[model samples]
Target: MNIAIVGLGVIGGSFAKGLQAAGYTNVYGIDVSESTLKIAVDQGMIKKGFIEANDILQDMDVIMISLYPNQIAPFVEQHKNRLKDGAVLTDVTGVKTTIIEKVSNILPSTVDFVFAHPMRGSEKQGIIGADHKRFIGANALITPIATNKEASLQLIEKLYKEIGFDQVTRVSPEKHDEQIAYVSQLMHVLSVAVVNSQQASEETLTYAGNSFQELTRIADINAELWSELFLNNRTGLLKSIEHFEIELDALKHTLEENDDERLKAIFRQATNKRREWY
Candidate 1:
């Protein structure tokens, strides 16, 4: 199991450490950030480290791309041909259709790219955030493109299970991206918008309520990384935001009209939905 992780950030580091803890060896960390590589090596998260993409794939049996969405196309283009024959290359990237489609279009048939998304993360970053505890019982969605489903879906699911993921669900790229656009991408947008709308002064934060505090916690996100995701999945995210706006407007209408009956009905609906939700 010669595994190569390109980002060496939170997800990559977590997966590397998880594999190691599962008794696997020969894991390699690859990242452009020299500091990140040093941190992983010092922590023994990966057996060794490499700075270049080429160096990392030389002996890699499986490669996981943990870079941002915008970086996926170019990264795949450069490494598609270099992959060892019969090697399985998957990614921890959130969006699937865009990445899987472009990569499959460019890569050779010998290379199997099993697209997957682990719906787990923390507000932290870098190798320090490498422990795979968050993934112990998290659901991992293994998204395989139509052309690649029969080719590598089973292998990807097996790997996720071996990594201690709680459950493995499969879906097409189109469906995966559509759902993520709401659950993952939309939440980030809402968090950003909520925090920005406040534009709170230092004093205001000092007086913030628990509810306000909890809602805006994710606002302390990596702007560069999140901004890329919002833009990459702009079409889907915009649609999610639009749906949210419509609902919010309806609530505002109820409040402005002081329609007690309508408000109660709305609250009842929300309560029922929340209670019924999984």
Candidate 2:
């Protein structure tokens, strides 16, 4: 299928790489940065694609908008008419409810846009870090609007399956964001908090423990992009952070009292909860 991916950063670039790895040809891309486009072409993720949106919509089979949350609404509004009738549209944005609602408001009846979120990402940004293998077995969430055809939806599912993500499932856009708040967004927030709280000198930081080091792994995130996500889904994210803080505060009180039995019980509960993944 001929695919046109907008916002050629991590998720967009990875989609191109995965499409190629799955033996799909005629993959196209659109991004504002010339340098990133060059990196994508040089890496052979795209065969040939134009940076101009209007110039490249003629033969676009399926469109994937992997942009930051705020862009989803206006971007789709502008391009809804340009996309060919019956062409399926989808996205890889982190939060889906607002985006899906924005899409629903502006989308023409002719073109169908489905909302999907692949549960895979990395700290790195841009085409430089694009890897097809990253989401090989990861969960890919598909949430189609009421207007979308069953066959068209299946086509998107088939494409993901071909790229080795058959563990696909359905989700309502609202629930997708609520679940992701704890699983993905809150993790970034915690990492940022850890990095912000630390005031160690460079030499002093060199002796950090394993857990301390791990806590800050995602702290130095790309602020510009992450800022967009955090604000767009601010409500859900704030609730997740608040609940996490409450849990942490309870543990702090346990430690202050040297409550051995309570600490052991808390650790045991965490272990039991974590063991389910094993």
Candidate 3:
């Protein structure tokens, strides 16, 4: 398949590498950065790279947009007509509702835009940090709108599997946002808060442990990207934050009251609940 990936950042760059590794030649990349384009070409991640949308997209079988949620709509709107007929387009943004709706509403009947979220990435930023290994055990969620045809969606599912994702599941845009709010967005908030809550002294730094490092690993995240994601899924993300706050308040009250049994019970429940993922 002739593929064009718009936005050659970490996710986009990684996707180009993954597609190339899967034996998909003719993979072209689009990015605003000239350096990124050159690097992508040099790394054999793409056959050609363009600084902007152009005629090369006219023959593309699939156009995978790996951009920020805010950029997804405008980019699709600007290039909708440039896409070839029967092209299967997809995205890898963290949040999906607004982007999917906006793009779906504007897309032509000749082309289909399928929304997907690959649950994989790193806290590191830019093309230099792109790593296809990130998707090794990740889940790829396909959030299809009514406009997406069965054949196109099925082809996308096959592509996800071909790209080495462990699982491929279909979900509505709404459900995808709600679930991601809890599983992904909330965790980033917790990590950021945990890192900020610390008041380290020179001596106290020596007492840091594995748990602290693990929990704060994602604290050094891309603030601009995360801020857009948080606002895009505001309602679901707010609800998740409220739920977390309530749990935290309960724990704080229990600790203040010196309720050892309650704390122990809470720990037991958390341990048991977490084991469910295994």
lDDT of 3 by residue, 39-119 (tens): 999999999999868758888999999888889888878888788999999999889887877777778899988888898
Off by over 4 Å in 1: 149-151
- In model 2, which regions exceed 4 Å deviation? none
- Residue-level lDDT for 224 in candidate 3: 89
lDDT of 2 at 163: 83
Residue 25 in model 3: shift from native, Å?
0.7
Clashing pairs in 2: none
- Per-candidate RMSD, Å: 1.7, 1.7, 1.3
TM-scores, all models, native as reference: 0.93, 0.93, 0.96
- lDDT: worst 10-residue window of model 1: 144-153
Inter-residue clash pairs, candidate 3: none
- lDDT for each residue of candidate 2 in 1-278, tens digit (9 for 90 to 100): 67999988888999999998889878988998888888888889888767788888757879999888788889878877688877888888788777777778888888888788888877888888888788888888887678889888888898888887858888887788888888889999888876776575667577888888888888869888788878878899999999999989989999999999998999999999999878
- Give the Cα error of residue 218 in candidate 3, in Å: 0.5
TM-score of 3: 0.96
